[model samples]
Target: MTKPLIIGVSGASGLIYAVHALKYLLAADYTIELVASRATYMVWQAEENIRMPAEPDQQELFWRDKAGVKTSGILNCHRWGDAGDNIASGSFRTLGMVIIPCSMSTVGKIAAGLSSDLLERAADVQIKEGKPLVVVPRETPFSLIHLRNLTTLAEAGVKIVPAIPAWYHHPKTIEDLVDFVVARALDTLDIDCIPLERWKSS
Candidate 1:
């Protein structure tokens, strides 16, 4: 049973991507170790008019155990500093790790090998374990500093995917754009999904 870790950061914009990805992964029957940053919860409240899981005990928001059946078991949210957690080690096999809407600060920290929190730590573990690590950064008007940080991680084999949705998809709604990027990230992780169409030189 292959699983993936989905980390949501407060970097800015696009919580929908995390939600959609989590939904799809669960629907696909993959277990997920989840992490949501403090700022991410705040952003969810301000922008999306939603609340973050209050504590690790709020696992019901993600985990669903109905009539002793594990339906919708994709996400298992834990405290960011829980280094003693199961997903903290490479021995716990997983398909990959993704940081959706990854913040520049977090990106720099991970690039520089600083794992101060569980999300960063899990990402570091993924890299060290030689597993796929995809970072979804939603910043625009890129600075040299951002590019350098992205490049640094890229050189180390991390997939630094900027959350720039393709216009070629003819998106009808914001959700369409979000799904397009998430689908691309899943593709990088080699997860089979139905997403956007590729640009062709016609």
Candidate 2:
């Protein structure tokens, strides 16, 4: 059986990053274990005006429609406060974990090995298992404390993929720019499911 990847969506400005990442991952038939923090829904509503259902079943359906995945791949949506989720254990055996739009608080908690919830617990599992852990942080004007927290994560073998898009992609629309960051985030996990314009020197 193919190992699934754990995707933890935290409260951040770029909710679409996780959306686009899911589209590609599903298209590639990669099964995913997904969990969204409480603040993620708040940011989702503020940024996209869409209310993410808190119920597990409804949330899975909501994600299905969002990613346009009718029946391609498996997406197991775990509840936010469920600390007993399977992904929380290293024995669960996963490909790795990616926290798209990871909040600074999540970063700090994971960096400090503090698993206050299932999301943080899952991420900590990845770190302890020495598996791929990619974090797509969305923050601007990083304070020294933020930088220190990020650096601490990086030093612990976490791939710190900031939510910065490249102009070299010559993006013409918001989706294009969003895809660039999502593509780079997947690149850290060596996943090439989604296509993007790679940089070519002039």
TM-score of each: 0.87, 0.96
Each model's lDDT: 0.76, 0.90
Error of 2 at 144 (Å): 0.4
Clash counts for all predictions: 0, 0
Superposition TM-score, candidate 2 onto the true structure? 0.96
| Off by more than 4 A, model 2 | none
| Colliding pairs, model 1 | none
Model 2 agreement with the true structure over 89-181: per-residue lDDT tens digits: 889998899999899999999988999989999999998989999999888889898999999989989999898888987889998998998
- The most accurate candidate by lDDT is 2
Can you list the residue pairs that collide in candidate 2?
Answer: none
Span of 10 residues, lowest total lDDT, candidate 1? 60-69
